[model samples]
Target: MTEAATRRVPGAPCWVSLIVHGLSATQDFYSQLFGWEFRPGPEQLGPYVRALLHGKEVAGIGQLPPDRHLPIAWTTYFATKDADVTAEAIRSCGGTVAVGPIVAGSAGRMALASDPGGAVFGVWQAAEHLGTALAGTPGTPVWNELVTRETASVAKFYQAVFGFETEAVVSADFDYQTLHLRGRPVAALHGVGHGLPRDRGPHWMTYFQVADTDEAAARVTGLGGRVLHAPRDTPSGRLATVADPEGAVFTVVRPPED
Candidate 1:
């Protein structure tokens, strides 16, 4: 397990959350898959629960209103020193702040925004909740990345909004860039061009760490989730892309053993 964060870092991926229609079923699927336990969270927005691993907060799952038609997907939230400032920066940088920099009780101030490419994300000014409490272990988020049609304009947007320094992959065939803050890589951007999913559009993808990628992929299938990509070895580790039964897509990875 990763060390608990004592403070939030501006522009870093601080949390990930999912909104689904069937909260109980979704919780059960994740509980069996990742050994998570759920606890009630602030209900200022809706029925929500914080997922915990060994009593440490790992992620969040919330229920959508019956009349709401928003897509069921995992949203990545970036930490900010000030949500209002971040929201204004997003707007001035050609991104759209679709939701408020409003307070969720005393948990935090939050706003939902989309980059120029229409990839949705959240900016959070934390208060009582300090975002994800544990990571880098099974059932916890390991990475957050934006898979979009192109990286240039969106990368500029992020940099202008969050002051991220970027490092591009020196490759002829690949279009990838890593966004960094304070000399540490925080998140990544990939240009998939026309290969972007028609149904999903441009969106952030969350990666959850697992002990075994192949086994996790199989478990996803057994739990009624779909494996969008079969487990494959990469320089980073073995990984698979998958979607929950509700169609929220994420990746599962097992890093190379030390």
Candidate 2:
């Protein structure tokens, strides 16, 4: 495991959380799939809980609020120096602040927003919690990708807000860009110009590292989750897209052995 002993750099993806209707079911499925351990969160936070890998925080699970209708999905939050400042910047960049620049107990300050392309994400200014404590290992988050049709606009919007260096990959059929922080890739933008299912819309997909993509994908189905895409080898690793039983999509990738 690669222990992240310090806070993630600003503008990098810091954390991810799934909003689900069945918290216990979600916990059980993930624990069986990824060997995660759960820690109960504050009562005021509803059924929110943190998922840990080998004693280090990796992700979270929260019960969907009954008051407002929301889809069961994973939200990826980027690290920011200040949530209030980032919220203002999001507005200035033509995005909408859906939730708040509010305190999440003593954990951190957070705000939910949708990019101009309507891809929802969050920003976290860590305090007592410094986001995920490990990466580049099995059961830890390794990458995040935003899929959208508005490639140019979305790229411009993020560059304006985060000062991200957008590097467009020259390709014939794929319109892709990598968001770099100080020359290091932090996240990716995949433009679904065509060939994707018509029902697909803009969203952020979180990728968790696994030891074996095929085995993890098999466990997903065994645990009642659906595999949206079968495992395929890529330059980065072997990856497959899968959704929890409630339909929150995420990716599992087995990175090439170092």
Candidate 3:
């Protein structure tokens, strides 16, 4: 079992949240899929719900502002010791700071930014809220990665902002790099080159682990989500890409049995 305390290493993906419409339906779908329970956040947070697994926070669900017509997405947040400094680093490094450095009640301060390639993500400076309490287990996020066409530029931008070191994974068909913080792998980047469908843009993808990929993919469809890619075995695991009823895309993986 993989476990980490509430505190996270800076530059690690310490929090994830879905921005979508219909909070009730979103809660229901995830509860059925992962057996997660919901807890209400501070009222000031505005329609935010915390997802708990066995009484520990695993993820969050928040409603998009009614006036904004943004597509539903899962935003992955990297841990930061100083939100203000991180926001400035992002802006100076060619990324756009879209929001925050604002207080999230007593939890911490947060800000959202879009990388030069247009992949949007968040940074969290923890106070009382230490972000995710459990991970590396079923139903909790296991990995987060950036998929874009501008590999070199994106690498430089992240290294400048977060001091991430890129280790290229030698592959013939794909250009992939692992983003490491001090020596541990925290996230990854994949260069799609000319392969991205015109309808899709660069974005951060969040991954959740399961015990059985085939079974989970079936359950997703039964529960009103769509499995975009059928389960396929990889060197690391058996995985599939899927979308929730609200059109947010993520991956589900069942690690190879020991």
Per-residue lDDT over 49-113 for candidate 3, one digit per residue giving the tens place of the 0 to 100 score: 99999888889999877897886889999999999999999999899999988898988889989
How displaced is residue 56 in candidate 1, in Å?
0.6
Local distance difference test values of all predictions, in order = 0.93, 0.89, 0.89
Total backbone clashes of model 3? Answer: 0
On a 0 to 1 TM-score scale, where does candidate 3 land against the true structure? Answer: 0.96
Q: What TM-score does prediction 1 earn?
A: 0.98
TM-score of each: 0.98, 0.96, 0.96
Per-residue lDDT of 113-157 in model 2, one digit per residue for the tens?
999878899898999889999877899988999999847889999
Candidate 3: regions farther than 4 A off: none
* TM-score: the better of candidates 1 and 2: 1
Ranking according to TM-score, highest score first: 1, 3, 2
What value does the lDDT take at residue 193 in candidate 1?
93
Top lDDT: which candidate number?
1
Please tell me which predicted candidate would have the highest TM-score against the true structure.
1
State each candidate's clash count.
0, 0, 0
Kindly give the stretch of ten consecutive residues in candidate 1 with the minimal lDDT sum.
1-10
